[model samples]
Target: MKITGLMVYYYFVCHKKLWYHLKNLNLENESENVGIGKLLDETTYSKENKHISIDNVINIDFIKRWEILHDIKKSKSIEEAGIWQMKYYIYYLEKKGILIKKGMIDYPLLKQRKEVELSDDDRKIIEQVLVEIEEIGKKEKAPDNINSKICKKCAFYEFCYC
Candidate 1:
């Protein structure tokens, strides 16, 4: 079972989502919001700078100035997950001796950018999250969905609801 930056993202957003993802039950392809997000990711940056996969574990949106990693998002609605996702990227690279220290979340739609740093505390949290994510992957079935306001915004809304 591989833990990806996307798993890290969904772990924070919804454990049930993490489980479904681990099971390969993808709903993003059927999601209009996901389509828009993919479009933004593709067109917001230079194609050459996109989809930089690190050791096949994490797919970075791009790396800027040869050091700073950037993740382009459509909005800041789930910014916490974005921050942790960025931190996970930093942690993964550091473990591989890449030693990246800075990250930024670019919201081209809003023209906003948020800087992220990998603190010692964040590294510890990310390690714990990786463990939790792996455990979720090994579950017998997808965890029970927890309804929330964010559900409507999630690509898995239809799968979880109607």
Candidate 2:
């Protein structure tokens, strides 16, 4: 299966969310926070040189120098989801044998850019994660909802909690 960076990201955030999304069940409208954040990300990265492509492999936010993939984010914290998202892009590019030197997570809110280098080990780990994600997606039920402080602000709170 062709996995996009977003899928990897969602899986990292909540496997149930990824399952819901892949199964054509989404609750994006239940939370305007997610929509607003998406808008801001698009607006912030909407540059003339930015190349947005939604292919079977992944939805590329921007291709720097036609080599590096840039994933622009607007989150306060650099979560595992964000890191895996960048790695997913790097994996796709590497699997395609493209000259993708690395990937970057551009946090406009923090004015910080984290560069991710894909080493051989990193690639292997990403592949393993992908396999696990795919297996999780095939399950019949969603994962248990473990309440956390982060869930208070989560876009999927209403669906998973209330």
Candidate 3:
């Protein structure tokens, strides 16, 4: 299976989300929050020069001559999940023997940029995380829904909590 950057993002955010997304069971299309994020993603990236390879493996949100992969986040707070997602992009590109020197996570809301680089050890860890995500998806039972402060802001809050 081709692991796209979005899958990696979902995996980092919520395992169940990745599972549902991979299985084409997502039901959050009606969420305005989700739509807003998608809109921001599209607007931030160049429409003509953008190149997407291997489904979601290489999503060049905005690429300049320097070959930098930029991911724009609309969230006010930076989270580990975003870092993991960026790392996964690096890992996937490196696994394919692509030349991805580094990536930048642009938090538009915070007006900050986080640089992401993958070391040899980081690749190993990302591979392990992917395996774990796949295993969780294959489980006979889904994990129990646990509400948290983050859940209040989740696009699937209504589907999972309501």
Judging by lDDT, tell me the better candidate of 1 and 2.
1
Question: Per-prediction TM-score, please?
Answer: 0.94, 0.87, 0.83
Best model per lDDT: 1
Alpha carbon lDDT of each predicted model? 0.89, 0.76, 0.71
- Lowest lDDT block of 10, candidate 3: 45-54
Models ranked on lDDT? 1, 2, 3
Candidate 2: which stretches are off by over 4 Å? none
Estimate the TM-score for candidate 1.
0.94
Estimate, for each residue in 63-136, the C-alpha lDDT of model 3 and write its tens digit: 55545677778884436777777788767666667777788888765668888887888888888887887777
Best model per TM-score: 1
lDDT value, residue 117 of candidate 1: 94
Clash number for each model:
0, 0, 2
Give the alpha carbon lDDT tens digit for every residue of 1-162 in model 1: 667899999998899988888998898898888899999988887755689887688999889776899999999988999999999999988988888869999999999999999999998999899889988888997788888889988888878888
Q: Which stretches of candidate 3 lie over 4 Å from their true place?
A: 45-48, 76-78
Clashing pairs in 3: 4-56, 5-56
Which segments of candidate 1 are over 4 A away from where they belong?
Answer: none
